[model samples]
Target chain A: MRMAELSRTSGVPVPTIKYYLREGLLPAGQVAPPNQASYDQSHVRRLTLIRALTDVGGMSIATARVVLSVIDAPDRTVRQKLGATIGSLGDIQATGDSGGADRDEEHAQAAKTVDDLLERRGWRVDETSPARAAAAEVLARFDRLGHHRVIAALDGYADAAELTASNDLDVLAGIEDEDELVETALVGTVLGDALLAALRRLAQEHVSGSRYRTPPR
Target chain B: MRMAELSRTSGVPVPTIKYYLREGLLPAGQVAPPNQASYDQSHVRRLTLIRALTDVGGMSIATARVVLSVIDAPDRTVRQKLGATIGSLGDIQATGDSGGADRDEEHAQAAKTVDDLLERRGWRVDETSPARAAAAEVLARFDRLGHHRVIAALDGYADAAELTASNDLDVLAGIEDEDELVETALVGTVLGDALLAALRRLAQEHVSGSRYRTPPR
Candidate 1:
């Protein structure tokens, strides 16, 4: 298909698709004699994934580029690809230096809490995984706010996360194609967060209403 | 304490604190002699909450103001406040008109899926809750991508969300002070999303490793 057809089919603007090509987010199409380029189904799939990463996943182009590279790499195993993709999803500033003794102590405590949770659950995750630090940072912030009760619910959150993660992997394990598997993993990891957060809010409303609201006569 | 002290205590810089004040995110301090003002512990706590909403919650200053106003409005019941706060957290553009027949059909299917999930779970959430549409949008995107497997896991995700939400309300119920309860609710809603996302990633790693990695002899 030509650029116009590609744009129409993918529901992306032609200029935006061109921008993605220029930015190396999408691979260049084959060019013919008058400088006309043609795209195929692979290009369409790539465009869909790009839109998912940027529009739905809320990832910056730079981070999306990194994730795309991980997806494109041929030598890495599926587990390796999953780790790199998840690593790219986190904000680097989250676990950066705090430069204060109080913050350092709080962070140390938070890290210990994460470590304890891992040990209690007997889950095997890398110590240096960005997610470890990211989770700890949230714990530290909760502590700073003097909300120990929220911190106490960590195990419950972890239990729920374990259930959801198992369901996520079960879906991933069903995909046979490597490209589709990685692409689905990326989409599931990113958009799944939005899905779970939205569902949690809905559930909160349900729980709050049941607990507090008066029953209609 | 004064402005400088408030800044020092909250770890938010003076200029940023001033900006929050100018934006009405923080209330005015008590006026003193020579055009000086004095702040109290309340200012420090407000600043902390403001930082959590913006930095940790990834909320815009305008959204933060809306949430803070909901926090300040004294007549609203806790359930009403939670509803408004959760509604405000979603992006307004998500459920807007997609201007396409295909998208409209997909959205209709997604909405039906959400309604079915609510019925299956016996959850009493308002039909108007923004989370319903937000979750539907995610489902629509998944359907567009031809990933039926991800969409198939919706019930699993909802089950996990229910567990976490139950844990969340338990913590909130323990807080006796209405002011602190609402404030903690705001922080928990925002930061708890991050906490859960990070933990889910970690759980994914563990599950992936356990299922895929070859054990050493």
Candidate 2:
């Protein structure tokens, strides 16, 4: 198909498609005679994935480019691709020791808490995984707020997280094509957070409605 | 304490503190003398919440003000306050029928999937809950990407979400003070999403490592 058809099929505008092409977010289509280009089904798929990442996942174009590069990399194994893809999504800064002694102590405590949680669950994750730092930052935020009660529920949250992660992997296990598997994994990891967060709010509303229903005047 | 003290205590800068004050994100302090005003513990707590909403939660100042107002409003019940706070956070536009026929049909189908999921789980969320629309949007994105397998895992995700929501409310149940309860709920609801997303990534890394571990070359 030509650019117009590709835009129509992918529900992206032509100028936006050109912008993506310019940014190398989408690959160059096959050049036809007289300066015309032709796009195939893969371009359509790439456009869809790009929209999903930027629009729904709220990733910046630069981050999406990194993720796409990892996806398009031919040499890496599926596991390595998956690792890089997840690493690019969160954008959480790693916990550092430069915030003076008080913060350094707090960050150390939070890191220990995360380390202990991983140990208690016996989960095999790299020490430098951005998720570890992200989780530690959250713990530090809770501590700063003086909400130890929330921290007390860490085990429950971990249990739920593990269950959801298993479900995520199960979905990926069913996909046979390596490219589709990686794409689906990236989409699932990014959009899945929004899905779970929305569902959790719905569930919270349900519980709150039943538990704290206001009586009629 | 005064402005400098509040800034030092909260680690928010003086100009930013002034910005929040001018923006009505913080309440006015008591006039102590001819030129100075004095702030108390409440100012510090408010500053912490303000920073959490904007910095950690990534909320706009306007939205943060609305959330803070809901927290500060004494006339609303706990459930109403919680509902309003959650509603303000996600910022998801509700599914509408404005995107032509095909999109309208897709959105309607997505909405049905969400409604059925809620019914299947016997959840009592309001029809207008933003989460319902947010979840539906995620489903629609998956549909657009042609990844139905992710949708198939919705039940498992919901199960995990319910468990985590239960844990959230249990923590809220332990807070005796109503003001503190609302404050804690707001913080938990906002930051909990980040925490859970981080933990899920960690869990995914663990599962992927164990299942797809690359043997030594």
Candidate 3:
């Protein structure tokens, strides 16, 4: 297949495909005798994944590159793909937004809160887990706003997270083919985030309707 | 009261606040005599929310503007605020990334899937809910990838979403003051998304560890 066919089949633009190729996000095609290069089924699949990550998952090009590397590497296993993709997805935020003079005190309190949450949940994760740090950062911000009550919402959030992860891993473990496993892991990591976010929005609306009886003002 | 004080209290840089002011994302502070403008507690709170939405939630300034407007509007009710914020938050992506001729067919199918999902879940939402469209768009992308398997994860994702939203609305309904209510709604809507995403990542790690007994590659 030519580049045009790759774009056509994948529903991605030709220039976008070229951009991914140049950025090394998509592997290069076989250079033919002429100027044209021939793309294969793998190229189409790769381009499809790239679009799903960027357009649906809202991951940046750089982050997508790292995710793809973990997914496509010869030695990449399901564990590496899951760890790296989840970590990279957690990286979709600007650092240092919680700057303040009491930063040290706030961080200390936040760390304790995270630790307490972990201890209560009895989840065995590493000290350096980005999700733990990310959760702590959110708690620190809630403290900053003089809205410590938001921290009370964490347990419910954690319960939902645990249940969802259990479901995800169950589906993952059932896959027999390594290639299918990698593809499922990648798609689930990327588009799966969007799916969850969308459902949450809908649920928010439903709950809000019942919580507040007032009409739209 | 001064710009420096506002920055100190909010932990947001003066220039960023000024940018927000210039961009109308932040309302102008009161202009006192001696060419001095004084910001109050409201400014600090609003500024903090803006930073959370932009930095932590990864929402663009433009989207944040629409959100803040809805939340801070003089005529906004709990109903209006929830509907508008959740709707705008769904606009966090660049629309129409799939640039092929089959976009209409893809969208038609996506819309049906969203409708079916809503009906199955017995969710009560409007015809024009952006969450529905966002979910549809994601399903369409999965279709484009020829990876229909991704849709299988939607039910589990919906379960997590419902639990999180119920928790969020419960916390939100507990606030007595309208100002406090609006603030919590804004912070929770933005930061809550990140918190859930982070928790999901952490849970993914825990599940993956137990699912695959093999070591990381």
Candidate 4:
């Protein structure tokens, strides 16, 4: 189908489609002729996934790129994707303001920032290393909390992360294939938020006890 | 100690501290001699937690305010806080973006938009309700995918969220005091991310089958 058809069918604009192509966020369409390209249903589906990561998951473009790389790569494992995503979460966390703005531009800047962070860390990722760079962006946000505080927290977080990762891995190992993966990803995203909410609630019971025992004067 | 001393010790700034006080993000300090004010170690600690949420956890000031409220409110329960946080997450998702800029001003605007959404939802929360508009925000992103494609997905997400919350509540139920709560919060915050990271890794194996049976061509 033509670009317009894809746009009409997908609700993404021609310009935006072009932008994704340029950014390598989307694969190049089949050459129809003289500067025109054709896209198919797969392109539309891919575009939907891209939208899911950036728009719904709040991932920056670079992080989304790494996620896509893993999803698309036949050899990519769940562990790599998780590592990449955990790193990507940091990227999302780094955005100081959750403004409604030019997503494409923000994504571009985020990608560059992620690249700089990976370089600074001396990470051995290729230029196409989306996960490494995505992780770097998250680390950079961790960096922005100021060196001392972030450093203090990073050690504790890393330690805790190891334990949690093991538990989660156990859960994932039970699931079987691609369908389960998407279902699990969807579940994980929402469930993760819910889990935090519940824990915060549960923690409050304990938090409130301090108020009674150590009344402030 | 005075605000300056608190700042030096906690690595928080006087202006930011002032902002917190004005916004009720921080507890009021004791007024000292000659129109001066004094803060104690607890204030410093609270400030640190505030910074972690904002800088590391990427919480908005408004959301931070609500979270702080829960922490400070002596009467709030584990169940209430948990429910509130879950509710707040939905709120945050609801008001995340309305489609606008990529900078601070736009972020502020988006925050305001979220505030509006919470108001519309009639949630008993401040403008800072972290979850006030989060769910809607997530939904909005998927709006581009068209209603039919995402409604079921959203339902699936909600279901998963409920289950995760239940599990997390179980974890929090064991804590007996504030110290434990703090420890739990810390561990949960860090480990939770790791757990999700692990689960996401495992889930990737099944995503292909879950999203659609046919490979995009």
Candidate 5:
């Protein structure tokens, strides 16, 4: 299909499709000539995915690109790939591996950064240094919070993400298929937003015991 | 205080602080004269909030700005104002009320967009068409998958977010402090992230015994 057809089918504007191509968020179509190209079902899939990540997941293009790299990277396990993807959430700087006595300089700096932010809030987190303690507390709180059901969903999500990532990796891996990779990234992102949004609404209903609460509750 | 002093106290670098000011993420300090500005405890507090929003909360500058607006907006109930703040996360598209319906177009568009994304992922959400049903399901799963202890924590978290949002709204209400409003937004974003990440981890740990598993015959 031509770009126009692709745009029509995907509900993305033609100019935006061009922009995705330029940003390396979409792969190039087969060159029919110097100025023209052809797209396929893969293009539709990829475009859909791109929209998902950007529109729904709210990931920056650069972050989206990094995630795409993991989906397309061969020689990496699902866990490793996901870790790399999660790494781009822009927090969680590397310390030496978890359970290591020594922390890396980058992680140490990030920890300090996080701590300072916490102390500024005047929230008490038990520790010798408020900043370090705050960062640790943030991690601890993740453990303390309830709604275990969400975690199970996350595990399922992780599993789904893994399966999708592997499936995508197999299709795009080692093929120099930037377009396919972008498509995979887009799908992952869009689905993630949909899933989370859906879950959030459900959770709100059950937890809050109201579909929409009246003001002043 | 000198930049170094501020850096040590805030645990943020002078360069980074400068970056924040330059980016308008933080309000500028009072200029004493040429080439000199004095920052006080307020600046320190502001910087701390800035860090929390950016790093811990993972909000974009634009989103952060919108949040701050709510915090500073005057003459509104805490509940009312916080609802507006939370709505920002949905990336609500601002379409002029074509005199059709207040939020109808926006919600419909959002739901349609959300629905399309979910359909691509093969999740069987009912066609009530708002995508709210689907979202609700996801959240329900979280509730089910979550550990017993986690529900207690989520209760606290929901309380915290609600409480913080309400009180923060009241404190800055009727003042039109865009900075404070943005600060409120930052708090919401960061706190939300912190709460969810914590919940996700706990849920992940207890997925086996929970009702989240496939029902056995």
Candidate 6:
């Protein structure tokens, strides 16, 4: 397929496809005799994954690239790929991992909170995973807001996460094609985040209706 | 308190406070004859909320403005405020609520999936809500990927959402002060999204460790 057909089929604009090609996010298509280049089925699938990550997953292009690197790495085990991909997709970028005295103390405290949560759950995950860093940032900020009680939701959130993680991995286990497995793993992490966030808001509406219903006029 | 003290206390920069003031996300402090304005405790609190929303919540200044407007309006009911706040914070922006024929068709199909999920869950949310739109976008993209089967996780996702929403509203109900109530309502919606996403990733690591641990070389 030419770029035009690829764009039409994938619903991505030609210029955006060119941008992805230029950024090396999408592999360059086979060069034709002239200036024209031709894409293929792989291009369609990759473009779709990129669009899902950027558009639905709300990931930055750079994050998408990191996730792609995980997908493209041949020597890494599935576990390594999964960990690398999950760790890279974290949205908490501005966290000062190292700072002055007070900030360092807070990060340590939040890190303890994170470790404690993992320990209590008896979940064997790396102590230094980016999720811990991101969660620590959230916890520290909540403390700054004088709402340390926000941490109370952590246990319930963990329960929910356990259920979701189980379901997500179950689906991953069923995919037979290795390429499809990797693709789903990457797109699923990002798109899955979007799905969960959206569903959570919808559920909030359901709760809001009954719990915070407009007081009778 | 003055702007400097407000900045110091809230950890927001003075220039940001001024920008919020100029943008009307923050109200102007009391004008003094010495060409200086004096802010108060409320300014400190509001600045904190603004920074939290913009920084941690990943909210645009414009969206933060919309959320702040809901918080400041006195006439809105509690449910109205909650609904407005949740509705306004959705990160999905490029949804084809208006688009070409094929796009609209896909949206409609995805909308139906959202509807079926809501109906099955006995949720009373409006069909046209943005959360539904966002979820539909996710579903449609998965469909394009030939993985419409990914919707299998919808029920589990919805279950987790119900649990989280209940927990959120439970906490919201315990807050007695109206100002704090509104503030928590807004920040919780955004920050809660972040918290849940982080927790989900951590849970995934746990799941991965057990389910996809790297095989012994």
> In model 1, where do residues sit more than 4 Å from their true spots?
A1-6, A36-41, A95-98, B1-5, B31-33, B36-40, B92-98
Q: Which one wins on lDDT?
A: 2
Interface RMSD of each: 2.9, 3.6, 2.9, 10.3, 14.0, 3.2
Q: In terms of TM-score, which candidate is stronger, 4 or 5? A: 5
lDDT per residue (tens digit) for residues A1-217 in model 4: 8988887665667787788788888998898667788889989877766666654454557766665665566676765654454444433342323323433454455466545533443333334433443344444333332222333333333333333333444445456676445434443443344433433332333343343343332
For residues B1-217, could you state the per-residue lDDT of candidate 5 as single tens digits?
A: 7666776666777888888777766777777766787788877766656555555555666776666666657787765564565555544221211223522443454455445544543333334423354443322222322212222222223332333233333333444645444443334334444434332322222231132343432
Runs of candidate 2 exceeding 4 Å displacement: A1-23, A28-44, A93-98, A210-217, B1-6, B28-41, B93-98, B212-217
Best model number under DockQ: 3
For candidate 6, what is the lDDT? 0.79
Please give the CA lDDT of all the candidate structures. Answer: 0.83, 0.84, 0.78, 0.50, 0.46, 0.79
Alpha-carbon shift of residue A162 in model 2 (angstroms): 0.8
The CAPRI-style docking tier of model 2 reads medium
RMSD of 6: 3.1
TM-score of 3: 0.89
Cα misplacement distance, residue B172 of candidate 4 (Å): 4.0
List, residue by residue over B71-185, the lDDT tens digit for candidate 6. 8899998667866777887658663223468878887999899999998987878756788888888988888787754787678778888888887777787888877787787
Better of 2 and 6 by lDDT: 2
Writing each residue's lDDT as its tens digit, candidate 3 over B1-217 gives: 9999988887787778889999899889888899799999989878877877788877778888887788778886865665666677775474535555577878898889888888898777777888888888888877877666557667777788889889887787678987788778778877877777778777877776666654643
Q: lDDT score of model 4?
A: 0.50
What clash count goes with each model? 0, 0, 0, 46, 28, 0
Which scores higher on DockQ, 2 or 5? 2
- Candidate 5, which segments miss by more than 4 Å at Cα? A13-16, A22-24, A33-35, A73-217, B2-8, B11-36, B92-189, B198-217
| Pairs with steric clashes in candidate 3 | none
* TM-score of every candidate: 0.90, 0.88, 0.89, 0.46, 0.52, 0.90
Worst 10 residues of 2 chain B by lDDT: B91-100
The alpha-carbon lDDT assigned to residue A123 of candidate 6 equals 82
Off by over 4 Å in 6: A95-99, A210-217, B1-9, B13-15, B95-98, B211-217
